[model samples]
Target: MAPSDPVVDPISSRLDYDVGELRRAELAADPVAQLRRWLDDAGRAEVPEPNAMAVATVDADGRPRVRNVLLRNLDEAGLVFYSNRLSAKGQAIDANPVASALFSWLGLQRQARVDADVEVIDGDLADTYWANRPQGSQIASAASPQGEVVADRAELEALVERYERDAEGLDIPRPEHWVGYRLVPHTFEFWQGRRARLHDRFRYRLTGGSWEIDRLAP
Candidate 1:
């Protein structure tokens, strides 16, 4: 017998939000600075997991996948996150070097979207970040076999216990399979929601190795 084909959903109703009130006047001169300001505001607003972002990547077949990952670092170079090289996300990134990330701060009614080209960071940078992590996190990294299927919770607990005992009072080394990745942004969009569904939207696109900011239709 053959397997059944998957069902597809039809087009849904259109819902429009006019983004007009969010003007360039509300943004910083520099997009990076604007992003930082939003991040700071999110932190002050007590948003849970302010540093967390939805990372999206495509597979070889062009199917997109997304998952929530902690934003470990961000700068002019772009956003950074760490993961196991052998994990599903790592494999997807290796196959397709392009990715996108989205940051949503519901409390502030703001969201930032980024589309970028990605590359794995150097070992030295990964090591420095690894060293700063709490001992428990380091131990957890060693114990968790990301993207692998385990028998049950007991198997994971056993591995955690073993690593905890083995790493007792010793310097936890960064695992060879774990590393950081940097996403170089080619385009970034900032969205701010306002009353009556009129919002602000500004986009920055890379042009001639420089950023060109423009007001996009809301």
Candidate 2:
């Protein structure tokens, strides 16, 4: 093919979402509650890794980074996920102390957004969760120096093997750098896709000590 050869456009592959309407009457007074309901729906629909979400953070340099992480815990307080304290996400959270998380359940034609303040949960909580993780995962988390460059896959595997040997006949402890952080949400948005590109969107904002809900143009 020539350098100037035209590339095929994949515009023909598109979807028309016709999910059910998101009515105000069906929404929970609390955004967290409403989000929980949607999460349940996602699980019931058999969406793979329903708890997975995309988290976005800004670094000290004012640049943004986004990555997918599993939602380890959720409640009225906020959403929680675990990571290495020295990882890029951790460093960004350290610098900005705020983040936005997005949960997309495309099969259900729905998405939920969370904008919140970040806070490190207590070490005890982190330890408990760590203890519950599979032995392999615990060893891998301990072995990985996340966001740091390695020579190659071979080096990473070697490190994992070393950790595996060390963890033999012992409970692998959570590394000091591995911990959980909670996002205490100040605002939330739930979007439901509809036919013809028009969608239903709602925003919930924390005002004073209560939450206020409003419909957003989509």
lDDT of each: 0.86, 0.94
> In angstroms, what RMSD does candidate 1 have relative to the true structure?
5.5
Predicted candidate 1 versus true structure: per-residue lDDT over 1-218, tens digit per residue: 99785464345533354433466767776677788888887898899999889999998788999999998888998889999978888889999998999999876778999999999999999999999999989998988999799999999989999999988989999999899999889899999876556677789888998788898766
Please give the TM-score that candidate 1 achieves against the real structure: 0.87
Q: List the lowest-lDDT window of 10 residues for candidate 1.
A: 12-21
TM-score of each: 0.87, 0.95
Residue pair clashes in candidate 2: none
**Candidate 2 — worst ten consecutive residues by lDDT sum?**
1-10
TM-score of 2: 0.95
